[model samples]
Target: MAEYEALIIGLEMLVELGIQYVEILGDSMHVLKQIAGEYKCLSLSLAVYPVAARNLLTEFREATWEHIPREENFAANELAQVATSIQMPEDCVQRIIKIGKKSLPSILTTGMEIDVNSAAITEDDWRNPIMTYL
Candidate 1:
C-alpha cells in the first residue's frame, strides 16, 4: 500500500470541493505526520506532488499541522486497509473523506530544540501576584 497516493488523492478532491486546511490523524506517522506539516518530508518527487494541495491552503489564509495518537485514526485506517485489499478504484476510496472533519488550526505548536523556561511569563518577575495590581 502506498502512502502519498491516498493522501494526495483525498486532498485533491477536498481541494476541488473548497476545503482549506486538512488534518490527518493516524499511526501512519510516516505519511500522516509529514503531510500534516508536523514534520518535513524532504524529497524532490514527494514535494512536487502538486501545488493544488497547497493552493487550497491559501484560501483559508493559513495552514498548520499536528500529530494525534493512532487511536483517533482507527476508522480511517480500517477503511483504507479494506480499500487496498480490494484494489478499489481511487474514486471509491475518496468517499472516506466524507467522514473527515473540517481542519482546525493545530493547537500544538512545534517545540524548539531548547525550551528553557525563562522568566518570560513567570510569576517570579514580581514579588507577589497581588503586587502587580499596584
Candidate 2:
C-alpha cells in the first residue's frame, strides 16, 4: 500500500514540475501490471490509487512502467524502506490526496505559492474530479 501511494505521489510531483515524459521502474510486479492495465486491483482503497496514478500518467507525453527484481531495485527499495520506517510527528498534518483527484501542485508559479482558495485552476490542468466523497 505504501509503495503504491509513494508511486502515485512521485508521479504527481513530476507532473507538478512540468515533466513531459517518464519511465517508471518498480520491484512490485503486481503494481506494475496494475499501472499497465494488465491486472485488476482488488481492494477498494488500493483501486482508487491506480486510477489516480493512471490519470496522472496521462499528463506525460510518454510514460512506461516496468517491473524489476527486488535485488536490482536498489535506490527505490532503500527509499521505500526508509520512508516506511520513519515515524511521523504528532504535529505533522499529513495531507490526504483523494484518489483520482488531481493532487495540489507542489510547485509555486512565478516564485509565489498560489493560495488554494484563491487560485483558479484552468481546464487545461483540471480534469474530472474522481474523489468527490473523500
Candidate 3:
C-alpha cells in the first residue's frame, strides 16, 4: 500500500512461506523505523502500514528489525515493483529467497582420543544437539 512496492512484495512472500524472520532495511528509515516502532508515526499514510506490520511481526520466530541506506535496498525496491505488477514464480525469485548461503556448522566431530574402554559423558551433548544427529 506504500509508495514503494518492495516492502509489500517481501511481506507477501514471507506470509506465503510462513516465514518467521525478516529484516526490513531502506533509506526510508523514518518510514521503516516507524513501522518497526523505533519512532512515532506522524503521517496518515505511514500510520496505517506500521500497525499492520507490527501485527504480522508477532508471527515470526525472530524478526530482525533494522534500517539501511537506500543504495543497499535498491534491488529490493525493483523487485517490489516487479512483484507488485505481476506474479513471480518461486523459481524466478530464488536468488532473493536466500541472500546468503554459508555451509552449516560442522556437525560431525570425532573424538580426539579413543576412550571406548572408559565411559565419560561430555557436556557438549546438551550444549549442541545438532552436532551429532545420530
Candidate 4:
C-alpha cells in the first residue's frame, strides 16, 4: 500500500518532467500486478490509485514495471527511510530528479524552471541582521 504511494510519487515526478518512458522497479508484487492489470484492486482505499497511475502511464510511450527482492533493493529502501526523517524548511524549494549510476544532475526543475544558483549571494547576505530577525 505504502509502496504504491512511493511509486505514485515517482511517476508524478516523471510526468512533471515531461519524461515519456520509464522502467519502474518495486518489491510489491500486488502493486505491480494491479498496475499491469493482472490482478483486481479490491481495497476501497487503494482502488483509485491504479486508475490514476495508469492514466500517468498513458502519458508515456513505454512504461515497464518489475518486481525485485527487497534485499536487492537496499539503496532505494535506505534512501526512502532517510528521506522520511528530514524536515523541509518553509522557504525550501523542492525538486525531483532522476539519477542514473554515472552522474549527479540538478532536480530543481519545475514548470517555472527555477534556477537555484541564480539567487547566489555574498556571505554578508547570510549575516544580515534585519533579514535574520524575521
Candidate 5:
C-alpha cells in the first residue's frame, strides 16, 4: 500500500510537470504487475491505487514501469525514510509544513487541477497548489 501510494504521488508530480514521457522504476514487482494488468488487485483497499496510477499513465505520451532490485532502490527507500523521520527545528526561519495521510486517492481531491493542453503557466496559475505541495 505504501508502494502504491508512492507510485501514485510520483505519477501525479510528473503530470503536474507536463512531462510527456516517463520511465518508472521500483522494487515492488507486485505493485508494478498490478499496474500493468498482469496481476489482480484483490484487496479492496489497494484496488483504487492501481486504477489511479493507470489513469495517470494515460497522461503521458510514453510510459514504462520497470522493477529493480531492492539494493538498487536504496536511494528512494532512504529518501522515504528520511521524509517520514525528519523533524524541523522550532526556531528555524522557514515555516514547518505538515502532511497528513489521505483516506482517498489524490485524484479525488479537489481544487488543484492542471491544464494538460496549456504548456505555459503564469505566476498566478492553478499550479500553485502543486507547487506548494512540492
Candidate 6:
C-alpha cells in the first residue's frame, strides 16, 4: 500500500514539474505489474492505487513502467525508509532542501580556528559562524 502511494505521489510530482515523458521504475513487481495491466489488484483497499497511477500517466505525452530488482534500487529503498521514519503534522507542507557537496576538508582536522568577532563578513558568510558554533 505504501509502495503504491509512493508511485502515485511521484507521478503527481512529475506532472506538477511539467514533465511530458517519464519512465517509471519500481522494485515492487506486484505493483508494477498491476499498473502495467498484467495483473489485477484484487484487494478492495488497494484497488484505487492502480487506477490513480494510470490516470496520472495520461497527463504525460509518453510514459513507461518497469520493474527492477530491489537490490538494484537502493536509492528508492533508502528514500522509502526515510519517508517512513519522518513524522510531520497533517497541515504541514513538505520541503526538499538541496545541499551542495563541501569543497573544503573538515576544519577540525585542518586545525583551523575561527575568529567570530571579525567585522569583515557578509550575510552569506555562514561557514565561519557554523564552524565556531561546532
Q: State the C-alpha lDDT per candidate.
A: 0.49, 0.70, 0.55, 0.69, 0.78, 0.72
lDDT of 1 by residue, 1-134 (tens): 24454555565566667776666544566665554556654553455332333433455534554555667867776886986676457667453333444232211121212222323436666546765776
Q: In model 6, what are the clashing residue pairs, if there are any? A: none
**Count of backbone clashes for each model?**
0, 0, 2, 0, 0, 0
Q: Native-vs-model 1 lDDT?
A: 0.49
Flag the better candidate by lDDT, 4 or 6: 6
* Better model by lDDT: candidate 2 vs candidate 5: 5
**lDDT for each residue of candidate 3 in 1-101, tens digit (9 for 90 to 100):** 44333454456558779887777666677767666677866554345455555655666778775666667767666876975676457678443334433
**Candidate with the greatest TM-score versus the true structure:** 5
Off by over 4 Å in 1: 32-39, 50-52, 61-64, 69-72, 78-134
Mind giving the per-residue lDDT tens digits that candidate 4 earns over 6-53? Answer: 666678778878998899888888888998999977665566667666
Model 4 regions lying over 4 Å from their true place: 81-134
Off by more than 4 A, model 3? 1-5, 77-134
Q: Please rank every candidate by lDDT, starting with the best.
A: 5, 6, 2, 4, 3, 1
**Model 6: which ten-residue window has the lowest total lDDT?**
102-111
Per-residue lDDT of model 5, residues 1-134, tens digit only:
77877788778778978999999898999989988999977665566677778888999999998999988888786887998888778788896575656555565562334333334657788987796789
lDDT by residue for model 6 (59-123), tens: 99999888889889987868869967876768979866543342222222324343333345465
What are the runs in model 6 whose C-alpha is more than 4 Å off?
Answer: 77-134
TM-score of 5: 0.61
Error of 5 at 30 (Å): 0.2
Per-residue lDDT, model 3, residue 118, is 27
On a 0 to 100 scale, what is the lDDT of residue 22 in model 2?
97
Off by over 4 Å in 5: 78-134
Quote each prediction's TM-score.
0.38, 0.57, 0.49, 0.58, 0.61, 0.58
Q: Report RMSD (Å) for each prediction in the order shown.
A: 15.2, 14.5, 19.7, 19.3, 16.3, 23.6
State which candidate has the highest lDDT: 5
Worst ten-residue run, lDDT, model 2?
106-115
